[model samples]
Structure formats: structure tokens, C-alpha cells
Target: MTIETETGSPEAPPKTRLHVDEPLAAGATVGLDHERAHYLRHVLRLDRGDRVALFNGRDGEWSARIDGFGKGWCSLAVDRQRRPQAPEPDLWLLFAPIKRTRIDFVAEKAAELGASVVWPVLTRHTDVARVNVDRLRANAIEAAEQCERLTVPDLREPAKLDQVTRDWSSDRTILLCAEAGPVKPIAAAVAGLKPGPVAILTGPEGGFAKDELDGLLKLPFVVPVGLGPRILRADTAALAALACWQALAGDWATGGADARPPFRSQEPG
Candidate 1:
């Protein structure tokens, strides 16, 4: 690690990632707003002509040079493609909201662990009844930028659990972290699934109501899975389930030129 100030706390220079909302191409010029300009200029202490990374989700990551700066904006000259646009695999996380911090945890971890979409659903036993979609979206963006992910997970409006279950896609498998009943080991369940779309369901700490559990279990596409003998917090269960699925059937299971993932989380907490 690079020394922060020799005598100061240890810190390396940040990766200099900026998520632009415009179409990016080689040799294109992109504008940065005041807030981002402030971040790059003051927070990151970047100077003119310094190199930075930029991505717009649709376009691939690019290495850019700070072209110029003004009162409220900064211009960047796109240099070259850093990483090609490769979206996360089709894995959706449908979770019930818990406490504020834990829900934030779910959003951050879901993006870091490769959730293509994050859907907040309201289950019968859920304690927290509301969600701040914008906050969740910001958390997703920060996580994506920090983790070097090409795209941020799509954040959806909160929906009722029953309605979500009713309109569920027939092609995608639903892996539910069950509150009770005969539960298949999560690892085994994920490992057995053929390559396809997936949606993992994790409810609030209070767990789903009897009727909700019963209805979900009855669905032909639903598969009740267990984490372990001990019950986990709502957020913990979601993380465990996501990691298990990725290792068994998702990108974590891919092998080619390199079995390692292209992205890495370099930002500190």
C-alpha cells in the first residue's frame, strides 16, 4: 500500500473511476458536472491532464485524460477502451426490506456480487414497510464504481410479494430461502440448475407468513433452499445465497482464458 502522508494514515491513490451518463467512444469528449468536478479536483486531488477511468454502463470502460476544467465542469478526452462492455449475468435478487443499514448492505453487496437487478418486495412479516429507491440506486452506483463492475444493478420500485410471485417468469428459476419446510441445501440446489435466468428470494428477519410460504412453495418454478441449521439475518441469507449461486452456476463458475474475474474492488470502506 502507498503511504498516505508518510506520517499520516495509510492510503493509496483512488482508482479514479467516474460513471458518466453519456455514450462513450474512443476520442470522444465527455463533460463532468460540478459535483463530480469537485470530487475529481478536491476529493481525489486529480490535476489537469491526469488519467482517469470512465464508464456509462452501455459503453465499455475507458481510460480518459482530463482535458480541461472550468467553474462548474471538467472535460475529459477519451483515450482508449479499458474494458469491453460486459454486463453481469442474469441474476435478480428479490429481497424484503429490513433495517436501513442492512437494506443498504443488501444493495451494496448485491452489486458487488453481481446481481443484475435488485427488486425490493414486501412480504407479510416484513417489519420495515418502506424503501428509498434513490438511496438504493446511489449505493448501487458507488458499489459498481468501487468494484470495477461494468454496470450497476437495475433498481426496481418496491412491489408486493404476492404480485411479484404471481407475475413471475416461467423460464427463470426462483430459489427461495425458506423459513420452514423440507429445505434442499442451497449449494446443491444451485449446482443442479441448468444454465438459465435465476432469481433468489430472501425475506425479512421475521420471515414470510404461513400463507406466503405456502403459496411460494406451491409454485412450480420455486425451489425452497436452506442456508444452514442456524437461521441467518435477512441480509446475511441473501449474501450467502448469492455467493453460493455464483460459485455453482453463475460467472464464478466460468472458465476460459482466465478463471479469475475481470473486475476487482479496490476502494476502501
Candidate 2:
């Protein structure tokens, strides 16, 4: 199944609805969880027998009928599955969280800009010790649904910067955004890099310590880059890097053809 965008339109055509939790299966009895039920019943004001489009990260999207509503459960009977869409590239965005509101903005934009994964790293200059994974997931879900994306970017549990880089893969390029120092332009750094997998690392609010910078720079595949002459906030740096990546190496230039890459499995069964 292929998720193709209508040709000849600069804007993304609207998708009727988006389902992320579970793929709609034909003749399969699927129940909406409590939160979803509230959203379907109250927020959306959707009633029984209404039609909604659903996509469960793995399955191609499908049209579903609201089977019934009673108690706390809302049932849906999936009918036909739409053509599957390509997932995002094997690109990941690893950065420290900014303030609460700005962090939320980053997650949302990352989803729209087509990041394969989002990693929240705790660096020496990080503002928050911990992050709300659930909130970030919600933001990603909404972004995917609204952007006509068939697959949602995976939001990994927050980890310390040191721990994440300890086992970093040599095949994947790591684009590190340095705020105060001169570095290669993002385009130059990404040029001709292998397309298999990549990551963008941005510093926190106050920026990285000299020691932290040295640690990252010592890594075999880390490529430090500058956003521009002016300083940007943590959130701005993240989104700018993502936009540059997508425009240069992502499917954004190809319409929706490159939007969906192969989906990444969460864990081994």
C-alpha cells in the first residue's frame, strides 16, 4: 500500500481522519481506550455509525465505522485498508528539552518535518532532569494526524547524553549543532553522507560545557554544524536542523513519495 499525495498541489491534501494506537482490521473487534473514547464521544462529538480513518503505525490506514458506544468502550469495525504510506527516513533528532512549552513545539514540528525518532538527552546544560513521555507522544500523534502522515515518529525514553553516545553506531552520521563556535554549514556536513540512518544533536538552553563538547567531538561519526551567525534558542536550533535535513536529505522535496520509509519495529517479540 502506498500513501500518495495528490499531484499538482503545493499544499498537502487533507486526510479525513487519523488513527495511531491500533490498525483498523476488517472483521476485527477493536475497542477504543478510555482517553480515545472520551475524545471520540465528547471532544469530536462523533456518534455511532460515523466513519473515521485510522492508521496504527504498522498497518496501512483504513476506513472504520463506529460500531457502538456504551459504558466506557467505543467499538470500531474497520472496513477497507488504504494504500500504505512510506515511513519517515531513518533520521533521528536527539536534543535536550527546552522549557515545557518550547519542548512541546519541537516535538510537534519534528513530526511534521519527518523525524524517524526523537531522543531527549540530559546534558550538563539541560534545563529539566526528566521529561513527560506521554505528553510528547500525544504531541507527535496530533502532528502526524494533522500532517497526513501514516507513521508517527517514535519518542524514546529520555537518557543521559553520555549513555546514549557510548554505543552510537558508526554507520549513522550525527549532526551536532554548536551554538557559540564556528562549524561547517549543515548542508556541507550532510552532503554525500550515507542515507541509512542519521541523528541531529542540539545543545540545551545554556549550551554544552567545554568538556561535553569535547566528548561529543571525539566521537567517530559526530559532525558539528552551525545554524547561523546569530544564536538560536534550544527549540529554534532543533527545528532549524530538522528543516534543513528534510529539505536536503528527506522526502519533503519529493512530495509524499519519500514521506514514508520502512517502519522501525519497537522491540523483538
Candidate 3:
């Protein structure tokens, strides 16, 4: 994708970035084709000679100057790599879909929160039976581009709980936010676990089924945890779990949360 920078004017233009599916390299003539060109030229009112930033999941972010635009084609001269790929944790978000909009929100937020992967789990009580992987991927790409994230979170295809859980590794602790009553708060559970690779799982609108919860609980690596006294929506629970994990064992504490340009996080307490 290519973006148009503002013309020579007194006002500072809004910062715009575009996500392209190609490797970005400094000092290269990057070309935009078809849909992206139209969006930049027509929708965004970007003209030839405008400046915009381009970033792919690899090669980081780069500055580019638009040379021309027309006939479903846009050209730009890549200047420099504006941002470098930063370190991101192995944190993953494994959640059951709630509804259309809510599920979309969860996918976008997971990308913004620095989750390396977003795994949509088909739980016993999950309401949504279908997921458009392409739609989720688009949402993630947009989120990463806007948020200046060099690395886009991988939105894995939705998998059944049993099938996915059976291959679980004991090395990575999986925190399942079971809505069941006895589970301890996530903060407490996280504090007790040895820090390394971590992932959080949130259930659907009706919560996890007893048999499903029982199976997950029986896993040696799965830690059944609670979010607090209040029951959260699937999306909210997923984001809250991410924040809590980042705060405790992730990167929110180190102030790395805002230090890196593309990704990475702050220190955890």
C-alpha cells in the first residue's frame, strides 16, 4: 500500500502509514498497484510527489516519496528505513469468538498489544461457528500499520480446543481464564508461574463447558485463572488478560511499552 503525504502547507499533516505485502528496502523504487493505488490517489486525496511511510512485516518501516499515480499504479522512491524491528515477546492470545464486531475488536487489539500470535479457539460453548481468516488478517495488518508496528501478529486459523490442546507443551504456561468460581486472579496466577513463554486463553459468551474446562484443567501446563469478581465479555477478557500478563510477567513494567518504535514492551514488575 502507498500513502500520499500532504502538500506544502503551514499545518503539519496527519501521520499516515501503509502496509505493503512486499519486502521494504531503502533506496528502492517501490511500486503500488491496483487497489492500493486507487485508495491513495482517490480516497485519501494523495497526489504525486507526496511523502508517506511504508512497512511490511519484514525490513522494518521506510520513508518513501510518491513519484506518480495513475492507471491503478503508484510509484515511490524509498528513502530510508524509518523504524527497526523491535523485540516482541512470545505472548499469544487464544480466545473463543463471541460475536462479529467483538471478535473483530479482539483481533485488532491483540495485534496492538504485541501478541505474537492470535489463536482463535473453538471451545465447547463458543457461539461463533465461522471465522473469516482473511478478514482477521486484514484487521491485524491495519492495526499494525496504524500503530507503527513493524511486526504484524499472526492470526492463526481457528482450531478446536481438543485438537490444539492435545499438543500443548509444558514449557509454555497457558493461562486459561476459566469463568468458573474457584480460579485465582490472573495476576496472582501469573506471579507464581516461572517466566518464559506465556499465552492467555479466554472463553466465549456462555463460557467454557464443564467437560472442556475439566480437560483443560487436567493439562499439566494449563493454569485455570480468573480475571476478578466480574465476568468479562470474551473480547474484554482477552484484552484484560493481555494487559495483566504484560504488567506482571510481560513488558508493561519496564517502560519498554512505549520505548520501541515498531513493537516490544515495557518491563514487567
Please name the candidate that would achieve the greatest lDDT relative to the true structure. 1
Once superposed on the true structure, which residue ranges of model 3 sit more than 4 Å away at CA? 1-14, 257-269
TM-scores, each model vs. reference: 0.88, 0.85, 0.87
Total backbone clashes of candidate 3, pairs 3 or more residues apart or in separate chains: 8
**lDDT (10s digit) by residue, model 1, range 28-124:** 9999989889888888778887777888889888778888987788999986676678756899999999899999999999999999999999998
Order the candidate numbers by TM-score, best to worst.
1, 3, 2
Between candidates 1 and 3, the TM-score winner: 1
Give lDDT tens digits, candidate 2, residues 117-208: 99899999886966998999889888988776778889999999999999787888889999755479888877757666889999898999
Report the number of the highest-TM-score candidate: 1
lDDT of each: 0.84, 0.78, 0.80
lDDT of 3 by residue, 1-269 (tens): 22232332332222368887777776788788798888888888887667778877778777788888879899988766666766767899999877889888998999888788999999888878799989998898889877777788988999998988888787988889888946887878988998689889988899889888888888889988888888788888999999888887776768763454322123331
| Model 2 score (lDDT) | 0.78
> Candidate 1: which pairs clash?
none
Q: Record all residue pairs in model 2 with backbone atoms less than 3 Å apart, i.e. clashing.
A: 1-84, 86-260, 86-261, 87-260, 87-261
